[model samples]
Target chain A: MPRYKITFAYDGTKFAGFQIQPHQRTIEQTLKTVVNRMAKDPDPAIPVIGSGRTDAGVHALNQVAHFDFPFDIPERSMVRALNSQLPLDIVVKKAEIVPKTFHARYNAHKKRYRYRVKQGEFVDPFRRNYTAHYKYPVDIAKMQQAAQDLVGTHDFTSFVASGSQAKSNVRTIYEAKVYHDEALDEIVFEFVGNGFLYNQVRIMVALLLEIGNGQRPLNDVKRVIAAKDRQQARMTAPASGLYLVDVSYDE
Target chain B: MPRYKITFAYDGTKFAGFQIQPHQRTIEQTLKTVVNRMAKDPDPAIPVIGSGRTDAGVHALNQVAHFDFPFDIPERSMVRALNSQLPLDIVVKKAEIVPKTFHARYNAHKKRYRYRVKQGEFVDPFRRNYTAHYKYPVDIAKMQQAAQDLVGTHDFTSFVASGSQAKSNVRTIYEAKVYHDEALDEIVFEFVGNGFLYNQVRIMVALLLEIGNGQRPLNDVKRVIAAKDRQQARMTAPASGLYLVDVSYDE
Candidate 1:
């Protein structure tokens, strides 16, 4: 058996998520189907493990994943082969032979995610489907300050969705920042963490949005973290604005 | 009746096109529905004539349109009211009172359109739905020169679609230029023209793409235009990458 590392991107609008579902379209299923066809196996029961699970309508710029195949395929040829079978909205950017021990999910050191929100009276027709549109005037300065409070290791239980089944709620967030891209008329929230609880990024964004809109004070972010109750946080932001930017692992 | 001009932007992914269709979702239909509701008339036959009819999956940043309303509505309030009823993908940016004779489609003096194509092995997930993905390396210099030949007034019959029913294809092109946006890994094609025939932009893009990929000679653009035959042009580019950038009327 040979293991291969693959980097890919997807629109995520038509996909349920990266995880495989029984009958729904997913990134994992799409990848597996394409890879199997390329490997000359009609129904290869290959399991693909992604770096992380993105919610519905969440996109990925550089998502990393790995799968094991029974036969050897040239790395360069694999990229072309997989892409030919994949839909236009999804593309395999790179494929490389990796050490058998490399695990896409377990070996990841850090993951970065970005959430985009348009704060204006008019939304760009081209970007409307991919970005969250909010007409309420947001205070970017307030949001930036609130984002700073969310950095560092802490129990993110309050930010996790109520139905999340993660065993531990504690995670170390290396960085959290919010800024406005004037050219794009979008507010971006970026986070890099060792691991994130389910819906953690979306909830944090929701909290910052509340502060940005003056619905809550900037200091409310710290109180929300300390409270450790899901009820204490603001509503979860829509999934359309969220993106899995990149995943990294130690060599 | 008081006539009002409205400037709007929309993500055209979900729209059939900018025109009203029978039992089909369209940007024009949606806007007319909102206007009819606000007019306090049951099934009011309000018509929203756009500056141009963008194809399905094409976006608009500064699209102009006008409709006659029997009641007076403040400019700012009209924007807010229409936005409240419209989907998140469509937004009314500006609204102003215009002369009773104002016409959205007929009074336009010039229009500008932009076509975007991604030129890298890796596609941006955030932009995949909005940009055309072209993995082949493009010869930028040749494409730019080819675009230059397309500038100026001439019969654009070659660039028109086969089923186009326009009486005249002679339109003046003020400017036609192609440039690469390195930061975004995109090649942008901009054209300022008095008017465009059906699928003219897409056809021009396809010809440029053929030149970029070395399938057609750089000088072939002039020959295609001279031929004035729709079959002389290359395939029509996808509509997802096209955008209606602006519309101008003589003062």
Candidate 2:
């Protein structure tokens, strides 16, 4: 059986999340059902592996996944056919054959997540859902200065929720930066990391926002990381404004 | 009774149009229902008058309208209250008391409509409804030349569908211009006219698109105006691409 790597995009408003559950609608289960139904050789079902799970109401501009098929299907045809069956909010962007050893989750080298923030007196009606609206002015210089503390390897247990039971919380953040687009009145934070713990990105964003608003000191990020306590990181940003932007791998 | 002028915006996907009907959903009907339910001094119902009727699936950025109220309501409070009752897709941007004789439809000096076209091989999923996808390279210079001829006063009977029973087809076009946003892969046509006939904006957009694609000659706009036959203007563009951008009036 040949493995296929698929890149997809979804609006995230209509889905529960990228994982399967008993009664809730999910992207992973929806994709698997569509792929199996459309396959030339129908099966009980095909297991679909995702690079990572995105929370409900969290959109994905580019999400990578992999699945095996009993029969051969052209890459372009697979994309076109799957998109026809999937809901309009979810679209299969690209599909291609991959090596048997290639794994969507295990073989991933790096991932990039983007958080959008709209800081102004009023939120643009059209982009209200896509951006986390902050009704006050954000200090860009303070945000940039605070972001520097998170741009290194550290145990990020403080950023993750208490429910997570990971053996280790060590992760390396390659780049942590914020870019403001004046035309759109939006501030986008880009984070590229070797790996992220559960709710890591949202929690980091919450701290950054606090620092930007002058509520928290600029060095709070470093203190939170060093404390290694979940109670220290109090806020977790909403899922609606986070997007899994890109995934990279070693060839 | 004091008349209130309202400037509003709507996404228009779920709405049938701006008018009330037997069973279908509409922006005007929705507004009236909300206002009736929220009024401290409720009556039979308030009639909401729109500056012009937008076709089904057409959006609006700044559509102006008016209605009568028995009691005084602050402009800011009215906007906030109406918005709370309206759906997320529709928003009342402004609400203010106007002259008793200010009729939304008849007192207008000019109306501005915008048509968006995206010329690209692939339609972006995010903006599929907002822009009409034209899968070809458009000649900007040709579109400009054709637009020049479309400006100024002319009898536009050729552009109106047979269903319209207007007294005269003559209308003055104050300005007609096409702006290309290369970064967004969109071509926006802006028209400020004294009035437009039924289906006039869509038909003009279709003709402009044909001219931009080099299918029609630069003089086709002039020839079609002289023909005065609906058959001369063969195409009418989709309503999803049109927007009621502005409605101007004398102070």
| Model 2 C-alpha lDDT per residue in residues A1-251, reported as the tens digit of each score | 77899998887867899999889899999898887887654655788999988888888889999999877888998888888788767778899999999999999989999999876444455665677878766788889889989998999989998777678999999999987976666898889999888889999998999899888998999899999998998999888789899899789
Q: How much of the true A–B contact set does each candidate keep? A: 0.46, 0.03
Interface RMSD values for the candidates, listed in order? 3.0, 2.7
Error of 2 at B251 (Å): 2.1
User: lDDT at A120 for candidate 2?
Assistant: 47
- lDDT tens per residue, model 1, A118-138: 865665555655788787988
> What is the DockQ for all candidates, taken in turn?
0.49, 0.30
Q: lDDT per residue, candidate 1, B1-251, as tens digits?
A: 77889999888888999988898899999999899988885554878788878888988988999998878888999898998898877888899999977788889989999999986675555676578878787888899899988899999989998777889999999999899876676899999999999999999998999999999998999999999888889699888899898999866
Candidate 2: regions farther than 4 A off: A22-25, A70-87, A162-167, B161-167
Each candidate's clash count:
2, 0
Quality of candidate 2's docking, in CAPRI categories?
acceptable
Highest TM-score scorer:
1
lDDT of 2 at B180: 87
